[model samples]
Target: MIGETFVLKGNDSNNLIKENVSNLKVYSIDSVRVKHFFTEKVDYIIEGNKLRRTKNSKIPNFDEHVVVYNDDGTFTFNSFPRNPPLTIPFQLYADYDFSDFDSIYGNLDKSFLSEKLKNKIAKREKIKIGVIGTSITAGAHTLEQFYHNSDKDSYPYLIKKAIEKLYRNEVVITNYSQNGSSIDYLGDVFPTALKDNNDLMFIEFGMNDHIYSWWKSNLPNFELTMSNSVDRFKTHGIDVIMVGFFQQNQSWDLEFINSTIEYNQSLSNVSKKYNCYFADVNKEFSKYSQPKINQDFCGDFMHHPTSFGHLLYYKTIIPAFLKEDVNDGFIYNLVN
Candidate 1:
């Protein structure tokens, strides 16, 4: 039995002693009594606490000891330990309907799109758009986790839907994105995929390139990668819309930050060099903080945006695709 005021003591081969004795009134056992108790099964009772065996009764070892806490405001144990505390930052977002954007953009003038470009898009038996990038661009968890429907929630899907509604379902979209891909991978695969002409294609890939060490080492190559991809597609008389993706963790390494800026600058340069449409998705998204919008809008805090986030992307890119002047003032109002 284990109880208040009673302490157990034991020693190793060196005859050293470790005791759990207290000053309070309790039964006392001498060294001989302790030795006899260990040698034989004597029912020693302890008040106010239960006794727990430290080892098998038939093969008990003195080194294996039990821990006992007394009602006298003290605890005795063979092990020494302490608990550590942890703290972390918490972020959340608000919920709002994003479908209103369809109507807003739908009401805009068709003059935004040049007559020649509009005619080419309208003449297509099946209007086509291509998407290329990393995991988020591939629509990972964007549809199932947030939108609940794969076809209705992805940014690419939303863009396709908006195009269909505007053109009365005359559009076809092809998504050729994959997880963990960079500009190098896209440069290799995009040419064959879009050998046939497309009305427009959206390109996003800075997240992977910025974070991976290999991509950081070959940062200068990003410019060539962007130039080749855009030039290859434009050769077929297809229009290109290059997007600069946003990154969530701003406190990441400076190298990553520099690379992201470099890649986005490269994207802008390429878009200009080839006279293609360019959207600064990263800059547009940075306008609103985590408190202003829901976290679901930006999934995994790394890549992918929620439906509302997608709406943000659409709001930013659609105007550019239509050739509308998207200065900071106009974009600021659209996001708010």
Candidate 2:
């Protein structure tokens, strides 16, 4: 039994009177015979198949007690009813569609990279590339989560490996990236990293910049930070490759969208100003509208991408480093 008693309050003119009996008195009524109770102006009406009660003052007041019985063991009151049960089915298709924005943005072409590597081999003693960014460059996922495997899966690792494979010789790659870092923080850090000679360096910083609202509006300051960082590396005879990383979940809120566009535009301006190589991963990742596909590209819903996604990054980034056309190779064929 549902262990509780609900009190009904009202006058007795139309309450508890069996038939049309006026001024009748009744101690209790069977709960099974009645469905619900309601107040009719100054009196209470006991509702069932038909209205049986008429004018009668026999209904008890608030202090009085009455007992009712029902075999069904269900209860009801004038208030709202309880909610029905719910069931949720598991979805296997989730996270199936995530894609690496780097691939989409870089518009990679492998044959072009091969040709560029051949060109570099012909022109230079050794191709030296420097990579600078946040945790992604530090090889967080490749070294930490996927440790036992080959580093060839990570974008940077893959880039380095691809270069080495093409050249069949030592490709010096200095990685100067820290976790939870920003462009402003790189001013001091990059100088030391580029102290050694570097031919190309990839720079990524939008992830940390997006977290700080103040930096978004201060475009001049952000530009200065990038300029200072790049100038330091260039002074050391290093060619700079600027990359703008994309957030997972292709959906960008207004604030992030605006900030990202602004930041990438600023980066592009700087790249052109200095004749530096640049890759726009944010624009590339925007192609996939589905979040599941986007997640597949990214590690979680942010930061880095999965192995396949990293491969896409490799496909996109390698071409830019080599200054090759992005529409003429296995990379172009695969992405299309």
Best by TM-score: 1
lDDT of 1 by residue, 1-336 (tens): 011111122221111011222221223222232211321123222222222122333222223332243475333222144111000011112111211122222212433333555775555446677788777766653434333425344567756655555445466778787777877887677665677466677788777777656765666787787888777776666667777776554432323456667777777888778876667776766665532222324443334564446666666576643333434323323333
Could you report the Cα RMSD, in angstroms, for every candidate shown? 22.8, 24.6
Evaluate residue 19 in candidate 2 and report its C-alpha lDDT on the 0 to 100 scale.
27
Q: Where is model 1 poorest over a 10-residue stretch in terms of lDDT? A: 82-91
Q: Quote the RMSD, in angstroms, for model 2.
A: 24.6
TM-score of each: 0.58, 0.57
Maximum-lDDT candidate? 1
Per-residue lDDT for 1-336 in model 2, tens only? 000111223332211111222322222222132212233323335442112223453333432322122354322211122111000000000111112212222322332223444466656457777677887666554323344433444566666665555445467777777777877777766657666666667787766676544755777887888987787776666666787776543232312446767777888888777766667676555654434333334433334555445554565466654434433233423322
With candidate 2 superimposed using the best TM-score fit, by how many Å does residue 212's alpha carbon deviate from the native? Answer: 3.5
lDDT, candidates in the order shown: 0.50, 0.49
